[model samples]
Every structure is written in structure tokens, then in C-alpha cells.
Target: MWQDFGDYILSEAGDDPVKIAEIGVGKFDKISEILSEKKNITVLKTDIHPKDSTVIKDDVTNPNLELYKDVDIIYSIRPPSELQPHLINLAEKINSQLIIKPLTNEDLNTGRVKMKLKNYKKASFYILR
Candidate 1:
């Protein structure tokens, strides 16, 4: 499923260099690392609690716009139900595409307009364009 998510990001990013943020990345940086290896993608991993030097410390509820200025894509892996709106808000404020990969069978709790459920390569996720 993570590979499916990564492939979706790569496809959305194309061959052009793009900035992408992974919200609430926590200790699992596999997807971010994979995306960063694409050579055209710059992945920024963020979390409220930094587990390593690579994870930036930031609160999704009130994200630091300065850190996410002009990002192309914002994605979260199994983000908490309560923080879905915050991710949506940040994506809207930055005018970036938002992708959320919630746990299997877990319904999205966000009520943001224009959110669409997408099944990319067996990866079931929500996208806000």
C-alpha cells in the first residue's frame, strides 16, 4: 500500500522537481524516503513530535506556512481523524494537492469541499484537488 501511495505521488509529480510535505510522518519515514529518491521530488517530513533529525517539528492544526510555502503536494499516512481538517486547511492555504491515506476501512472525518476518494494501484486514499 505504501508503494502504491508512492507511485501515485510520483505520477502526480511527473519528471519535474516538486516539493511535497508528509504531515504527521512520525517515525515512519519510508514513504518520504522513497519519494525523495525519485530525483525530482523533495520530500519534507513533519510531525508534532520529532522522532529523528530528519523529521521537522510542526503542529498540523496550525502549520507553519513559512515552512510549507508553495509546496506542490501535501500527504498524510493514517493521520488522526481530528487532524484531517488541518491538513485540508493547509493544502487550501497553500493551494496544493492534498492526499490522505487513512487506515483501512477508516472513514475520513474531514468535511472539506472537493475531496474525492481515489484508488490508485490498490491504494485507497482521499484527494483534495
Candidate 2:
């Protein structure tokens, strides 16, 4: 499933040099690690309580717009329900594609914005563009 998620992002990148950001990246780095290895993709990991120097400190509710400037894609893996809407807001503000991999069967709290549910191989997630 993880590989599927990474592949989906890679497909979206499509050989283009694209900037991607991972929000609420607490302790998980697998997807970021995979994306970082690709020559065409630049990955940024952010968390409100960064566990290490590699994870930048940024609150999703009030994200630093500068950090997301020119970012082509923004994805969050299992972000808390309360923060999902904020993620959508940030993505819209930055005009970047948004992907949210929420917990299994967890309903999104996106309000009026409807995100499409996607199943890419074994990975299941929601996408908003």
C-alpha cells in the first residue's frame, strides 16, 4: 500500500521536477524517503512537533505559506480528523494537489469541499485538486 501511494505521487510528477510536501509527518518517513530518492521530486516533511531536524516545524491549521510556495503536491498520511479541513484549506490556498490518506473508514471533515476517494493498487486515499 505504501508503495502504491508513492507510485501515485510519482505518476503525478511524471518526469517533471516537482516540489512535494508531506504534512503532519510525525514519525513516519517511509513515503517521504521514497519520494526523496526520485530525482524529479523534492519532498518536504512538516509537523507541528517535529521529532527531528529533517521534519520542519509547522502547524497545519496555520501553515506557513512560504514553505508551500510553488509546491506541486501536498499529501498527509493518517492526519487527525480535525486537521483535515485545514490541510484542504492550505492546498487550496497554494493551488497544489492535495492527497489525504486517512484512517480506514474515517470520514473526512472537509465541510463543503468534496474530495474524491481513490484506490490506487492497495492504497486508498482522498484527492482534491
Clashing pairs in 1: none
Q: What tens-digit string does per-residue lDDT give for candidate 2 at 1-129?
A: 999999998888888899999999989899999899889898999999999999999998888999999999999999998999899899999999999999999999999999999999999999998
* TM-score top scorer: 2
Error of model 1, residue 82, in angstroms: 0.5
How much lDDT does each candidate structure score?
0.89, 0.94
Q: What is the lDDT of residue 124 in candidate 2?
A: 97
User: What is the per-residue lDDT of model 1 for residues 1-129, given as tens digits with 9 covering 90 to 100?
Assistant: 889888898899999879999999888888888898888888888899999888999999988899998699999999999998888889989999999999999988887465788999878899988
Candidate 1: 10-residue stretch with minimal lDDT: 107-116
Which residue pairs collide, candidate 2? none
TM-score of 2: 0.98
Residue 96, model 2, lDDT: 97
> What are the runs in model 2 whose C-alpha is more than 4 Å off?
none
